[model samples]
Target: MVRSLKNPKNAKRKSKGSKKEDGSSSSNSVPSMPAKVWQPGVDALEEGEELQCDPSAYNSLHAFHIGWPCLSFDVVRDSLGLVRTEFPHTIYCVTGTQANNAPNSIGIFKISNISGKRRELVPTKTSNADTDMESDSSDSDEDELDNEGPKAPVFQVRKVFHEGCVNRIRAMTQKPHICATWGDTGHVQIWDFASHLNALAEAESNISKDASTVSNQTPLVKFTGHKDEGYAIDWSALVPGRLVSGDCKNCIHLWEPSSDSTWNVDSKPFVGHTGSVEDLQWSPTEPYVFASCSVDKTIAIWDTRLGKSPAASIKAHSTDVNVISWNRLASCMLASGSDDGTFSIRDLRLLKEGDSVVAHFEYHKHPITSIEWSPHEASTLAVSSSDNQLTIWDLSLERDEEEEAEFKAKTQEEVHAPTDLPPQLLFVHQGQKDLKELHWHTQIPGMLISTAGDGFNILMPSNIETNLPPANATA
Candidate 1:
């Protein structure tokens, strides 16, 4: 079930200094609105507190669930321009299922007409029944208003049969129609999504038709070299069709495009990690250079020109590093998330000097599920944790005593950040349950699509300061 997004709204700070009726000067203190701060793992809910996402916080928000729960998904890069800022947006995504007692199939979903504010489906019951009644009536009117826009968003899916449950899915950045899937049964398979993409594109023009078009069980290429199944896989953005897949058995295989639609999988797997490889990422600038994090509590940077071992290995975290994202805009910065609810940003340039972790955070209460740097903003990034919070962070923001003092004077002691809260924490979004992954839309500046056990949330917060000066911006 999708819960109402719970958010704390900061009251707008009004201009200081107003004249009193007596023409005498009075302390220009700003009034503070009620502060609803819910630190995901830190704060517990009151007796009957329900999350109500402030609708004004989002430019677009929508949620929908597929029949089966999916653990991994990817946003399909389309022919559409790299930048799109228009109403009623359309997005394409591919995901696979982990069903308990049904056939597993990979699906391509076309989500369209996503333009509307979130409306409360169920009114929260309060102690005062009259207030609750008024809230219920207000929600009814708002629902009608929500419908006044260009119709509610829709999902059109086309499926292709697969043998075993899919562990993770990654669409090629250059050729989105071709995607690779890791299977639970010790195998990696590549599938062409040309047919699926065509069908979804056609469905968009005529959304009235509703049917599941299931294709035959076939993959473009298949490999069963790994002894154990795993989840580490990545498609190189620097190289057109170069791919890498790492398994639980400390092995990584490289896939190079040999033809228009086929890839040459090297049988000699690259091996270094003594434990399971949890994640892999190709460098944004170097075609042969990539990074991998493993359960051994370390991250390894590998170069294909070198032999089987990592070019350089670092003791990256205290526990298993579950995820990592190499900054595309700022190629020197690398971000990593660990199983112990901690994430760190490292400056790759400092590796030769010594340990290179420049910034670290332990704000998440649970293991981080995903972390990604914003494609548009060099100093901004977003992280999702199993604690059900997708937090956006701006590394450029720092604690300034003067700014803090001014903020306190404006809020009039009504609202203040907890001492433990970091100044970089820009926004906290909570609504979904068991959130697994999130990615910033390459085309939209602040737009993001997140997948969770309940369903998915497509959100673009209105508060992402567009004018925040970027550093080393060349994305």
Candidate 2:
């Protein structure tokens, strides 16, 4: 279900040592290094001159240099609206396990904007030449922070925990301080990061330079039920401690946290799909409802009140539906991406037993790896295709009224018409290889992070300017 496809093509930090919760001495430091001198867009800045990013630049894609690369990752915004990026190590996984026999690690990076001055990142095109040159020198450069004014972008590595591949990570909505991680080992783990965040903050304020390693730090809770791995897990937004996970065995397990603070799993698995369950997403508004898509090319909506059978199921694609996302704005609106390089947006309210696709987008030439609805805008969502392009779609703009209405009116559309004119393809971002996931920053309306084989990208869509009215201006 969570497989990496082929090319498209597409930061350093410092550390210090301290004691961790597990009584292990480890290097505890957030990512910290002086900003690089290469102006984002070619010739955008002079030598020794700091970057003064335009306010509009925040609406476009800007790639940053995280010291390491990534395969899977998650972006979680804290209560203060600050964005934090968490992902397992890219090179460390291979070398650490093979060479040192060390457990895989997850790196926590906090993004900050210091804005007393008008410093911002310029829109830079990462050409092939620049990519080659920076590959060797960019990460290891230990340049000091130059006087770029107070508005420069800074990233701090809060902590790095010795763990596993961590194929997937999702932050809890009800308990923002907690997040869940799952991997190829078929283990699901819960982690409470409040104390770690605090410790990082204290170190930052005190400017601790001694590096520390967090070894054998255990998860808050761990559970295992699935015989096969490579599935998706989600925490219910409507119900605290309630979780639903899907696996390759076509089984869905429902879990609830008990009084003893441990998860309890149901003996009976929710079985319906003929193939592997690729993804599962819970209803933003309903506690008992959720939806799952599978390699069977079908998407099923399940209600916990019912037994293992799905309340509604539809043949969604010609190939495996690799991923599905629920529209945060419209609860019934759902989007699904398939291995056939196609994706569709469907209104579950108008769905029936047969093929129930509302609008089909076929721009992707490879498998669509990830699709996500924007938390700030109802009709806008972004999708990453294995073709190495991250395209943003806006359903509210320039849509054909007649076709949309006809598509919605039918209980089921037997044949999906090839989108004569594609839905408004708002923006296409480049410069990432094998892009796996894209997530809109919940606190920052226009910002979203993409994790891929090359590294991480913090991008602002081309149309983000529209979301930046005077009332919602951010730093």
Candidate 3:
């Protein structure tokens, strides 16, 4: 069982905030002009109310309950037993109940509604529900006629690799296939889901004969140079064979894969961050150009064209820079978030000789953990902070008309034209705890996935709907 971290409310505070530069309060506060709250539906209830059925079983359960409903009961139940599988649309529960004279065998069931003739109850299906139903029915001929009828979903917990808690998870695609990266103390393994599914089938064929171990499993390619823990990793968008990784040693290393299926480390190391380099991103347009942010309160842009030193360095924040993202639409644009409770956007094309203060945001009060740009829209970006909030911004929309007109006039002669409207503050998603990562899907740009220290979540733009959620929804 994985233990939950102590809530931030229990943490000890260091000092009260000092006064601001303009004599205003330095402490963060909600606006005096209250904004309207959006209530999802009429079935909303306060924190501690118990519903008729398990909320986690249904993806649409949140459609009934708004905001953060109390999930202690759900967590307690999960702790007491085990969930066989948590899919995008359903949750499978496994229970071990006595059957014959021998030890009880495991049975699995889907925890969803079933309606037959007149009765309605939660439906239970086997793990192989699509294929093994006929075999299950033939094996239990005697019990089939016992009335009380078909049993309610019988939960049989399966042995899942990273079951209870997952600290971090990332996915990478190599041509027609995809692999997942999981953070663990053991050798970093990339599980090929397609191959693993086939292995499970082979294991099942030998189950009755008591020889079920599948020895054909492939191990993941591990990077072992980092003596300390590896904290962050980013795949090169331009070349999937190359990747960049950061470690707790305050060092960043570039890795390239060789034809012999081995990874080679580049001899030169990027070593300017006084503290650990927390984040790194490679520009999509400029493959050789990448950015790195660190606890040393600096953000540096490096061009592989330059042998060692960074091309440009900016004193980005008052504290550690935790996250950074490059705008896919705007080739010269980049954004970084920091522990100093601020995020800044810079234009690589414009930063020359004497120009300072590109564009900065001071909206977040706590450390910003992750920043992401919209894959479909260049001007849109989203950020997640330790304060448990995700804010979306449409950067193309300018707030000041006079300033926007002047900016347009100044850059109008260029080939590309700037939009007149100020970027829109799309929406704010709150109630998560200590969000650490945010990733927008490549195929569907509006959809995003985020993982926090508390739990994993998926966020879709309010206007969009998806038939099936992404596989890594609950990372």
Candidate 4:
């Protein structure tokens, strides 16, 4: 569930003279300070200026860099309890990198004690060490002066060599120890990282970060079935070990879990989209149902039990539909982000060809790199973009004309938006360059982890209004 207003700070903009939406106001007028909210896709920086994050917007923010930028990564569900609301969070993440000249690798990281001095106000790694962006944690933090026993945060990496650069990486939800990767060499590989997981947990590893000679680099199964490199891949949530992969050639393959710890990938491919499939999401509730978005500007719903054709399809956007997130909590709700930086929410029950759009917003100026629904909230979703911003939105919100008038009078903002910026837009996170993908931790209520050109960020937004008390709140 979302709060009445996304940013609690925004409520301060209202004057005591102005009536609340429910017609309540203070008996005595108390003027407030100017309300300053950055409008992305609309605001531009002047000369000698740069964007800075309002640190109060975050609960706990920590950033770490892998030597090379990872194009994709997945948070491994930890046994640290499924509903973590406490601080000093620990998480395991698996990622594959796309390096320049260096050999690519898959790193399983144990990032722990991800807590720092809470900032009353802060921004990028540039503004202060205690800020929004990353790099406080590295592969080897030996030389940093922290004689006081892990003061900031620490990351332990067990990296195994990979053949080619990984285009995408995903850990199977049912079996987190087993993972799959899509490589630029038109190869799809499945790996069992039980030993790697053990080594990371034990703070010991034999696998060198760049050595391919180690037996651990070998994948349990590799299929060169796809004609070209692809980014669309997903493990089924309904069925353990079941997987689905879609490629640039518009061919999708199904992997049935075999008893021998191997996969039986069908030789025949599922064909539906005319362009490259950009992303895939299995139905959180139904094992056989899944969804795919493509460069063809459409989203397709497929059932593994049905034939190659999609069970249903929608012309989703004007440009390529870069990503689609199927809401796990609200099964009928689906959200999509496009290459054009516009994102929309849809109610799948209105799956007809004409219109199913429940909400739409064009706030980002570049292609949407990744989009995901909050596993904990049915109406909330997050989107990352090439515009270098990640935005959180709650579809349950609507623009309050009176609230805006008060805010506008205090801030002196213009009358119209770039066609009325959806009030549902809650928070905007910046400071990552060449941003690629982001994911919310299913085990942690409000925690999020994202990968970009700079590295990775693990932050919980203070303003997003989660069910848990503030991280600093005492028991």
Best candidate per lDDT, number? 1
The local distance difference test score of each candidate is 0.77, 0.63, 0.48, 0.75
Q: What value does the lDDT take at residue 256 in candidate 1? A: 94
TM values, all candidates? 0.83, 0.72, 0.56, 0.80
Give a tens-digit lDDT track for model 4, residues 328-435. 989999888888888898989887656899888877878888889998788889998887788888888887888767766764545333345567887767777777
Error (Å) of candidate 2 at residue 213 is 3.0
lDDT of 2 by residue, 208-290 (tens): 53223434567887767787775577888788889888888899989888887677888688999999888999999888999
402-447, model 1: which lDDT tens digit per residue? 9777766664554534676799998777878888889998866678
Which is the leading candidate under TM-score? 1
Residue 434 error, candidate 2, Å: 0.8
For candidate 1, what is the TM-score?
0.83
Better model by TM-score: candidate 1 vs candidate 3: 1
Task: Output the better candidate (1/4) by lDDT.
Answer: 1
Error of 1 at 411 (Å): 9.2
Q: Give per-residue lDDT, candidate 1, residue 126.
A: 36
